[model samples]
Target: MPATSSTTEFSRTGNGSSSASTKDIEVQLQQLREDISALAKTVAAVGNEKATEVKGKAKRAAADATDASYQMVEAAKSQAVSLERDLERQIRANPIQSVAIAAGAGFLFALLSRR
Candidate 1:
């Protein structure tokens, strides 16, 4: 009867050591939850930083492409102006020869159009 009573009392109160262990488990669980929250916040901050970096890289790439196209257009305009000046100089140096060549081209064009 004494052993039965002791067992019943132990089961009801869960003994001093068991109760302390239970408290320790609860504390550990709470600490685990806080640690997980901190880790999630760290991950979000890193993601935001990466997103900002990618946006900056994209903007720089777009600006570089725009600058390259502008340079190409300027080069084309320069070349066209140079070609026009060269053609004028050639015509002025040999006006009679230029006139003869022009006449021959006109004759060939007229003949082709008739065909």
Candidate 2:
């Protein structure tokens, strides 16, 4: 073959190679875009799961606090009832003394208020 013919063949092959390389780059770019999209979706799902878990923990904490508060209120009510009963029993045992003490306290309160 002539030198010129060999040179032309080389030039044609080079052009075809460049075209194939460009097609390969385009395919790789499309695959990369797909991978990125899939990654984003995965990240979003994980984030949602974590958020749900945190929400559940918060709800459980709130319920526990409410139960504790309710128990405290019940305890306070029981204590108040016990105290009232004791006071009533003492007053009934010494009606005259209780009346005298109440009057003295009232007089002292009146004097303090006037000042």
Candidate 3:
């Protein structure tokens, strides 16, 4: 009787090494390519999400600035109206005194204009 040796179909060079199979190497390479593609998609998704978040923050800031500006303008207009009303009331209460003040101001303007 002769002794027998066991070998697998993928074990070439008679070394029982399945790692030498071209089919196995190609399969691993294909899996690596797929993993890289998935990683790229994930990175792109994260980038897009960050961009959207920043855009939203910028829009909110702009809206807040506009609201503040409108409030300030309204306040200035209210102050101007209040001052005008006070002046009108003063003129009405002392008509003769207002006339004297106006005459004095006119004389000063005339003197200054002569220069």
Give the alpha-carbon lDDT of every model: 0.97, 0.99, 0.88
Cα-lDDT of candidate 1 = 0.97
Reference-based TM-score, model 3 = 0.59
Residues 1-115, model 1: lDDT tens digits: 9999999988877877798999999999999999999999999999999999999999999999999999999999999999999999999999999999999999999999999
Candidate 2 per-residue lDDT, tens place, 34-106, comes to: 9999999999999999999999999999999999999999999999999999999999999999999999999
Candidate 3 Cα misplacement greater than 4 A, ranges: 1-26, 94-115
Error of 1 at 30 (Å): 3.4
Best by lDDT, which number?
2
lDDT score of residue 99 within candidate 3: 96
Alpha carbon lDDT at 54, candidate 3: 100
Better of 2 and 3 by lDDT: 2
Candidate ordering by lDDT (highest first): 2, 1, 3
Q: Report clash pairs, candidate 2.
A: none
For candidate 2, the TM-score is 0.76
In candidate 3, residue 95 scores what lDDT? Answer: 96
lDDT tens per residue, model 3, 22-92: 66788999999999999999999999999999999999999999999999999999999999999999999
Model 3 clash pairs are none
User: Pairs clashing in candidate 1?
Assistant: none
